[model samples]
Target: MDEVARAFLLPSALIWCLAGWFAASRRGLSSSPVFAGCWLLALAGNLSLILAAELLVFYFGFALMTFAAYGLVVHQGSPQALNAGRWYLFMMFLGELCLFTAVALLAVAAGAATALGLASYHGLTLGLFAVGFAIKLGLVGVHTWLPRAHPVAPVPASAVLSGVMIKTGILGWWRVSEPHGPLLSDWGPWLMFLGIVTVFYGIASGLNSREPKTVLAWSSVSQMGLAALLAGLALTSPGAGHLAWLGIAWLVLHHGLAKAALFLGAGLFQDSQGKARGWIGLLLCLPALALAGAPFTSGWFAKAALDAAVIEAGQGAWLPWLLTAGAVGTTLLMARFLHSLWVTPEADGLPTRGPWLPWGFSIVCVLALPWTAWVPEHVRDMANGPLALLSALWPVVLGLALYMALFTRPATAIRWPWRPRAFGPRAAIPALLPGLVHVERRMHRWSVVGTLFMFVIALLLAALSLRISGPVA
Candidate 1:
C-alpha cells in the first residue's frame, strides 16, 4: 500500500480496535463470544483492505467483513435473530458472488492479473461493479435482507451495521468510478430510476410495520436510496462528481450518527424501561425527524445538497418530485413510530436514568455535526432561505396530517398488548425446532459446499454469456 492508503488504514484500524474493545469491556466475560468474534473479524477484514495490494486480498477482506456481520446478526440466539441472520448471510454471499464475477470479467477484459485497485476497470467492468455494489447498498429487490437483519441484531451491532458497514458499498462504487469517470454517464438514468424505487419502497413498507425497530430498519433503506440517487446524478454529470462525493460523505455521516443513536436508544428503552417511558419515547422522535430532513437538522443539509445537485444536472423535474414524496412517506413512518410509543402502557414504576453522557453525546452528534461539515459554501447563502425552510417544513406537516388522519383513532382505542399471547409461545416452537435444528445438523455441514457449487454455476453462466456477446454495442 502507498502512503495515502496507509494514512487511511491507520484511522480505520484504530476505530475498529476501539469498537471491539468497547464492546468487549462493556459486558466482559458475560458478553457473547460469538458477537466478539464477529467484531474482531470485521475489524481485521476492514483493516486488511488497506493492506490489500491485489484483487484477491481485497475480495477476501470484503468477504470476511460480510460473514462476520452475519454472525453478529444471529448472535442473540433468538429464532427471529437467526432467521434474519440467515437472510443477511444469503444476500451478502450472493452479492459477493456477483462482485467476484464482475472482477474476473474486468481482469479478462483488461488482460491483467489483478483488477484490485478499481482504477484499472473500463466501461463494461464499471457497469458490473455498479450492479454488484448496488446489491450491497440495498437497492430495490436486493434490499430485502436489510429490514430483516437490522431490527434483530443487538443494539450496538445494529447501529454499526446500519451506520458504517452499508457505506462500504458506496465507498466501493466511488473507488470503481474513479477511472472511467465520463463513461458512466450511460448508466446514470437506470441508477436514478432504481434509487427512486428503493426510496419509496422503503417508506411504504416502513409505514406498514408495527415495530419501532423494524420501521427504523426500513428508514435506513430509504436513506440509502437517497444516497444512490445522488450517486446516479454524479455519474450523469462528471463535473458534479465533487458534489456527489460530498453528498455521499454527508449521507454516511448523517445517517450513521442518527441511525446509531436511534437504534441504541431503542435498545436501551426496550431493555431497561420496557418501551413505556414517555420521555424516552419523545426523545426517539428527534432521530426520526432528523432522518426526515426536518428543519435545521443534519438531514436538511444533506438533502439540500442532493436536491441541488440533481437540479443542476438537469434531471431536476421528476427527481425532486420523487424526493418530496419520499420525504412525506418518511414523515408518516416517524409519526406512526411516535404514536406507537405514546399509546403503549408505561411500566409500573418511574424509570431509572442511566449514564447521560453517552446518550447525550450520540444525540448531539447526530443532530449537529453533519451540517457543520457538509453544507457546501455555494449553498450557504441559501441555507436559511424561504424555499429551503419551506421544503423542510412541508414534509413534517404532511406527516403530522397523515398520522392524525390514519393512526390517531386506532391508537386511542387500542390497549397495549403487554403480555405475549398464549399462541406466541407456540409460535416460537415451530420456528425454533425445524429451522435452527436443520441449520445446525444437516444444513451447517453442507453450506460451504453448496455455496461453492452455486458460485461455480454463477461464474460459468457469466462466462458463457460473455462469450456469446462480444461486448455492449
Candidate 2:
C-alpha cells in the first residue's frame, strides 16, 4: 500500500482495537456475539477498502462497512435505536446508489482511455459523487441521523461510528477523485462551500444540544467540514494538493483519536461516582483540548497545516479567516461536550472492570502525536512560536467566555431545537432539524419512493452507458 493508505489504515485499526476492548469491558465479550461479529466485519471492510488496489474492491469494502455498521448502531435494540437504524439504512442506500452510478460512469470513461471523453461526463459524475460523499460525511441536510444514531449506540460502537466510519467518506472521495483530474477544477469550489456550511451548521446544532454524545456527534460533523475545506483547497490548486492531503491525513488522525477518547470518556463518566467522576473529567480534557486546537496538541498541528495549505493555495484573503472563526466555534462545541458530561446524572456506583487502560492508552496516543516523526518539522514548530500560541489560545478563551454567558444564564432563558431529557434509553432529544427529519420521514412513507429513486438512478446509469457506448438516437 502507498503512504496515504498506510497512514489511514493504521490509525483506523488502532482506534477500532481500542474501541472494541472498551466495548467488551463495558458490554461484556460473552454477552452478545452479534456486536462482536458485526464489529469485526466492519473492521475488515474499513481496512480492506483502504488497502484495496482497485476501484471495485474499494466499492465492495465501502458497502460492507456501511451495512455492517447498522448492527452497531442499533445494538441496544431500543425503539430509538431501531428508528435510527432506519434513517442510517435509508441514507446509506441512497449514498451507495449515487456512488455506484458515479463509479460506473468513471469506469466507462476510463475504459475509453481518453481524458477528453472522460471530461465530457465530468459534471454528472462529480455531482453524483458529491451527493454520495455528503451523505456519508453527514453534511447538514443529511446530518439528522448522526445525532440520532450516536446517542442510542453503546459507547465503543459510537466511537468507531463517529471517529473511524465517517472518515471513510473522506477516503472514498480521495480514492475516487484522485484519479480523474477533469472534475476537480469545476467541482472544487462547491466542495469548499459545502464544507463551510457543514462547519457552522454542526457547531450551531451541537451548541444547542444538551446530550454529551449528541454534542460530540455534532463536533464530528464540524470536523468533517474542516476535512472538506482542506479537500477543497487540494482540489483548487495543484500546487497545494500534496500538502492539502497531508493536512487531511493529519485531521483524520487528530480528530479520530481525540473524538474516540471523548466518547470512551463519556462512557466512563456514566458509571463514575464523585471521586471517579472528577478523575474522568481530568482525563477527558486532553482530547477535549485537542478538539479545541490547544497548542502543541494534534488538533493544533492539523489546523496549522490547513492554514499553511490555504496560504499555499493563495486563498489567503478569506479561507484562513473562516477557518479561524471555525476554531472558535469548535472551542465552544468542545466546552458544551464537557459541560454535558459534567451535568449527566451519576449511574450505578457498583463499578466493575472499567475501560481505564484502553482509554488511557488512547489519551497517550493523542498527546504524543505532535512529537511523532509522522508530523512535519514546520507543522510541529507552528505550535511553538509566541504569536502562534496566542492564535490558538484566544479562540479557546473566547469560546469559554461565550459558553459561560450563553449557557450559564437562567435555564428558561434559552429555547434550543432540542433540550436534554433525563439520561437513559430515551435520553436523546430526537431530530435536530425537524423540517428535514419530516422530509426524511415522508420519503420513507413507502418503499416504492425509494425504489422510484433507484429507478431514476437506473435511468441515469443507462443514459450514461449509452453516452459512453454511442450517440443517442
Candidate 3:
C-alpha cells in the first residue's frame, strides 16, 4: 500500500515463495497436503500482516501466522519437533497477548497520543509492544524457542521462520511505535547496547555449536540484533528518516534471501552426492559470503548502505567498527556451518523432486539480488572507489584467517586466554532458567494449551471490541 509496506512485503513474499517451492519438493511429512495447506495459511498470514493498514488486521494476521506455523514445526511428528512446537506455541501466545493488549491501548490512546506523541502516551503500552515484537525477533532472553524450533522443523519451514517470520517484529515495531521520542529517550541507547550483546552472544554460541541448523538459528538472532542497531540509531539521531528505515529494509531483504538459501542448502547437504553434492556445497558459499559482506555480494551493498545511514545518524565514529565486528562474526558462523555440512551424515534417501531445483534457484537469486532494481539508486553506488571495496573485503579476510589459525587444526587452536569449551548459557539454560521444566510440562497438556489459545483469542477480541465501541455505562 505504501513504500514501507512494499519494502517489507517484497522480501516476505520472495522468501516464503522460495521456501514453499523447496518444501513441496521434499518427501515424507512435507509431501502431505496438510503440510502444503498449513504452509499456505502461514504465508497468507505473513503477507496479510505486511499489507495490513489497520491495527486489528495486523494483529489477526500475526495471530494466524503464529498459530499456523505450529503445524509446520510439528509436521514430522518427531519427539523433538513436538517439543519444539510446544515451546514455539507457548512463547508465541505470550507475545500475541502482549501485542493484542498493546493494540487496544493504542486505540484508546489515539487522541492523547496525537497531542503528546504516541510513544509518550504511556511507557507500559510501548514497553509491551517492544517485548511482544522482541520475542518474535528472537532477542536474547526470549530466544529459547528459536534454536529448538529451527533444528527440529523441516528445512523449508526453518528457512521461512528464520529468514522471513522473525523480521515481522521490526515491521510491527515500525508500525505502532517510534524508536525515539520524549518518553523513550533511553530506549535508543538501550536497544543499541542490547543489540551489541545479542551479536556477541550469537557469535560465541554459534561458534561453539556443531549442528549446522542450530548455528543458522543463532545467526538469525545475531542478524536481528544488527537490524535493531540501525533502528536504534534512527531513533537517537535527529537527521535520521527514510534513509534509516530504507537501510533496515534492505538489510531484511539481504538477510532473508541469504539465510533462506543457507537453510535450504543445509537441507539438501545431507541428501547430496556426486556432482549434486559438489554443486550444493559450492553454491552455498554465495549466500554465506553475502552474509559475511564479502566483495560484490548483496551483503557488501547492504552493509555499505547501512554504513551510509549510520554516518547520516552522526554515529560515524564508532558504528562502523561495530558493524565490522558483526561482519567478522557472521563470517565465522558461516564457516562453522559449512564445516558441519561436510561432517554431517547422509540422509537415507533424497527428496522426491531432487534438491537442486528450488535451492539452486534460491542461490541464484541471492547472488543476483544486488543487480536488481529493489535497491535504492543512491545505495546502488555506495560501494564506489577502492577504499569502500577494501572495507567490505577485510572483515571477510580476517574471519577466514582466524578460522585457518584456530578451528582448522587442533595444534593451531588457541586455548591460552580461555579453554575452547561451550562458552554460553545455552548449555546451562535448564539450571539457570527458573521453573523452566515445570513450565515445559504445563505446556505439554492439550487441555492447558487449548484453554490458553482460546483465552488469548477471546481476550484480543474483547479488547478490540471494547475499545472500538467504548466502555459500558
Q: Report the C-alpha lDDT of model 2 over 1-473, residue by residue, as the tens digit.
A: 88779779878988999998887777454378998899988999998888877666777888899999999989888998999898888788888888777667766756733221123345556567677777888886666668789999889999999889989888878876665543466567877898999898788777767799999998998999988887887888868888888889888998999998999989888878879889999889899999999887898888888877887889867777788889998988898888878988887657655779889999999999888898977577656689888988888888888777556644335554364533321222133334433344454444644664666487567546555532111
TM-score for each candidate, following the candidate numbering: 0.80, 0.87, 0.85
lDDT, model 3, position 276: 69
Q: What is the C-alpha local distance difference test score of each model? A: 0.67, 0.79, 0.78
Q: Model 2 residue 258 lDDT?
A: 95
Assess candidate 1 and give its lDDT.
0.67
Runs of candidate 3 with Cα error greater than 4 angstroms are 109-121, 178-185, 349-353, 410-473
Query: What residue pairs are clashing in model 2?
Result: none
Sort all candidates by lDDT, best to worst: 2, 3, 1
lDDT of 1 at 143: 72
Tens-digit lDDT string for candidate 1 (316-423)? 587777788888888887776666545545445665444344555577776666456345675555456998899888988997886664556544444434322222
Model 3 lDDT at residue 132: 83
Best by TM-score: 2
